[model samples]
Target: MTANRVLYLLGSAAPPVLNIAGVIERAQAADWDVCLGLTPTAARWLDDELPALEELTGHPVRSQYKLPREPDVWPPADVAVVAPATFNTINQWALGITDKFVVGFVAEAIGKGIPIVTMPCVNAAYVRHTQFDASIATLRVMGVHVLYGDGGFVPNEPGQGRPNGYPWHLALDAATSALTRRDAGRE
Candidate 1:
């Protein structure tokens, strides 16, 4: 199969945000042309590394919506992974809320039949929110591969996330598997 264009959608959770370089390296090694879209707060968190990340991906890291007449700079995504998907982002995305650029792209990707794999990086405390479980269920019903709980992203205790334990590879693996499944169906 040809190399897939992967969009790495990042939210404002600390673990994956801090270790984004590993995510990029693994994706590139897997023959993916990766681009990044950061939620606004995530952009702020990774401000200093933005230039390096852009250089690594060879595409601008988008954090805001482009103007109506402006052409999109990044390649059209064949698959997307929303790693470090926060509680807020998950809920907003499921609800079709497009207040942020990342959420807007994800919502549109759903309609366009683009395969999306998401690994939520929320704490146990936040995971207990009533809307959180419902939102995840809704996204799953929409055909999104949500990596949470067993065999996926287990919820970390409040303030207990270890950067080393964040499952960036799992998200990438899921994205590749989803793409493979999608292509097989076509054949």
Candidate 2:
């Protein structure tokens, strides 16, 4: 199979970031060219990891607004995944507020009608918050896929039910399923 171009959007949450690098590695092995989108808040966790990501993906990580003087080369993304999406970022994107580079890219993707999957990493409290709920609802109405978060096995806790974490492999499956469904409808 040809490598699919996937854009990996990293949020500022801990568990999500914890698995991203490994996910990138897996994607690379599968021949997918992964593009990294790091939020400004996420940059705090990216010390040596940023360059390592570039090395792993063979494409520069795009976290800032400034592009190179000359047009830099990058593979067109086949799909985009925002793993560990923050409540603020999700709300902002859903409400059309692209204040930062990462959110801006996601906004542009939505505008262009590209395939986007957001795996949110939110506390149990915020997940039930009104604004968060509304934002996700608006996003779904606008055709964005929100991977439902749930903590498997555990009945209740803060940040319990997320589609990410140790079950990172499931993410690829979830993304594939969404893309397949989207493409099938188009056909």
Candidate 3:
């Protein structure tokens, strides 16, 4: 069977952001051809690991928007997962903002009918923002699978989250299930 091409988008969250290699490994084990994309802050955070990440995924790690005439490097995504999806990314994406490469790719993916799954790594304090709930609601309405709350990533109290506690596997599993559901629907 052909592997599913997954765009593994990252945001600037503490735990999962630092464990990107593990995320890639999990995705690959599940038969996904994973491409890594990062928010600008996330890119900066993972600066020293860029080379290793590129080698891991066999594609350039994209953080910024490329020049208009530049050729696209990664394969077309069969699905996209934004693990450690930060509050900023979730809000901006809900508002259709694409200033960053990761956001832009996901925005376009939605229109392209690619199944997009997001597991937000936000704190309870930030979740109180007026836009946060509305943003998630909008994304869910747009058919983005937001793995938050009870069945997914639960909000931790501010400054209490441990790197080991982040649910990286849940994000991958949600992506896989979404792809399966999409395929089953086509059949």
- What lDDT would each prediction earn against the true structure? 0.86, 0.69, 0.86
RMSD of 2: 3.4
Model 1 lDDT tens row, 103-178: 9888999999999999888889998889999999999999999999887999878988876888787888898899
- Model 3: what TM-score? 0.94
Q: List the residue pairs that clash in candidate 3.
A: none
Q: How does each model score on TM-score?
A: 0.95, 0.81, 0.94
Return the lDDT, model 3, position 107. Answer: 89
RMSD of 1: 1.8
**Candidate 1 structure lDDT:** 0.86
- Cα misplacement distance, residue 139 of candidate 1 (Å): 0.4
Model 2 per-residue lDDT tens digits across residues 117-167 = 776666767767789889988888877777754521111256465435345
